[model samples]
Target: MNLYQQAEYWLSAHKIDQLPEDEGIEVAFAGRSNAGKSSAINVITAQRSLARTSKTPGRTQQIIFFKLDESRRLVDLPGYGFAKVPLAVKQHWQKTLERYLQTRRSLRGLILMMDVRHPLTEFDQEMLNWCKLSNMPVHILLTKADKLSRGKGSAALEQVRSELSGEMSVQLFSALKRVGVDEARKRLNEWFQITG
Candidate 1:
């Protein structure tokens, strides 16, 4: 089976203490609320409901894990920068996320999703900066490409590329149109050391 088909929901963790033992490679998906992170996961995995997508932003409140096999997994992190959530909950998320990013031994890389029209927000930059400090690899997906003209989308991609320096990779993606799915799969496979 393909890597996507091998994915199965494994567990969810609301607190750092609840996380599974660090033993395998894990690539995490992260973004601001309503940035289409879940939708992108669904599209990439070819599992329409594997990661729940909601019209209401900030619905995902925990770190969700999907096992690809015994030693490879995908992590869906809680969406940050939601205004409506209570301050206490937001603080908890901030702490949990920071701890995970700083200490998770199995984490191989991060897939940072951003909407095509609104590529970088303050929170996105914060995430990028943290990854930079930690020397972690990040792949930015400019999602919702169907919302823009092809020329505009390409221009946005170029602009983001020029703005970022280092090992980061950026791509245009559209869950609606299935753009960049293969490239995403290839990167994920490489990160997880999955072989055909």
Candidate 2:
């Protein structure tokens, strides 16, 4: 069976304590607002509504969890770097994300989604910084690849890989055309050591 075919609902947490017991490995997905993180998750899971997509940027405000089989979980952290959001709310998300990254031991890795056109932003760097500081593994998925030409996509992929300095893997993706969907799924399963 496909690795993601066994996915099931886990739990969503508004706070760290509210998270379920750390019995399984976790792989978190995060990106800047409007970066297509939700779309990428939905594509990988083959479940259209597993992760809510929005035309509006920064719609996710919580650390949502979706279990992939019994040994692994997919985490959807709130998108960062949305300037128009209220200052209070942004600060809250920052604090919450910081705390989780600093303390969540069950976190096995991170799927740092980025727009293929605009690979990494300041907020993206901030998130990467946290991952670096904590020594967590990260894999970047360059979303919206279909929007770019074949040549452009290749160049963009190389640009991001070279510019970012971390122990993170990277891949180009397009949920619209389903490009790199299988590769991304395979990589995630390999990273988490998930097998049927």
Candidate 3:
């Protein structure tokens, strides 16, 4: 908790060159628009507004970094899919995302957030495939678990697990219910400790 609580806004990179120096390890959080990405980050970090939640989707238009210390950081990537933005803006973000993911040596892992009701969207699959190709570690967070009954939530988890069998770690989560916060934090800690 101490490490996450120490997270403070570092910088926002609209272009690849605007990013911090590629040195310390960082874990990126990514999800489709409206997938509760901000809520999950705030909950994991124990900060109410660390990632900036919004009723309107696609408010995070750039890669925002939250520094946990000198050698650690949490990156909030721009949400993709259904952002209601102009085509040129979306194109720029797509290009930026591709370049970062492929070239960021300091990026240790990715925490992929997906809404429980909508587990694997087209965009999510593309991310998974890209990670697989690059041999990047990924952890999936099925956010908004509190919106479903216990049985339903478990079922959704199982289905996703079965589909992606033997690939990556996954768990149910809910920012509002405080579900799986510890588990998520543990994963983050493990990744941070790793040299990547």
Candidate 4:
């Protein structure tokens, strides 16, 4: 069986204190609402419903954890910038995300997702800046690449690649097409210290 096929629903944390113990390797997924974050997670785990993809944006309202093992996990951060969600709820999640990212000791890296057609929105730039300041490694997925033609997808990838700083990496990905899945998995394995 695939390694990530073992992923199980761990817990959901509305507050940083509600998260699991801080001893394990934790890699987080962050993105603007509707950026295909859930889809990417499901694809990465090779489980169709692992992250709860939705027709409606902002469905992920808390920090959801998937335990890959006793010492490794994947985190689904609350999607941001969904205008339909209440301001109070959005503010609460913002504070929680800020605190978690700043203080989580075991967090080794972030997998950031952006829609291929709309890479690097304002909120995405904010996240990139914050991660940079904290010296966290980030690998971005330009998701929904299947939405565009091959030439357009490559162009989009190059454009976003040019904008990133040295420590960050970006790639074209389509969960639907399984594009770049291996590349993304390689990065995740690096962060988790998984080796053959």
Best by lDDT: 1
How does residue 156 of candidate 3 score in lDDT?
A: 95
For each candidate in the order shown, give its overall lDDT on alpha carbons: 0.92, 0.84, 0.90, 0.90
Tens-digit lDDT string for candidate 2 (99-190): 88777778888899999998777877887777778788888999999899999999989988886666777889998999998878877877
What overall lDDT, based on C-alpha atoms, would model 1 receive against the true structure?
Answer: 0.92
Q: After superposition, how far is residue 70 of candidate 2 from its true place, in Å?
A: 2.5
**Number of clashes in model 1?**
0
For model 3, residues 1-196, the per-residue Cα lDDT tens digits are 4799889999999999999999989999998988888888898888999899998999788899999999999999989896578999999999999999999999999999999998899999999888888889889999999999999999999988876633488999999999999889888989898322
As for TM-score, the candidate ahead, 2 or 3, is 3
Across residues 95-176, which tens digit of lDDT does each residue of candidate 1 receive? 9999999999999999999999998899999988888888899999999999999999999999889878676899999999
For candidate 3, give the lDDT of residue 14: 97
Q: Candidate 2 — what's its lDDT?
A: 0.84
Model 4 agreement with the true structure over 36-101: per-residue lDDT tens digits: 888888988999998988879998988999999899999998888999988888889889989999
Over 4 Å off, model 1: none
Residue 99 in model 2: lDDT: 85
- TM-score of decoy 4: 0.97
- Local error of candidate 4 at residue 72 (angstroms): 0.1
Model 2 weakest 10-residue run by lDDT = 1-10
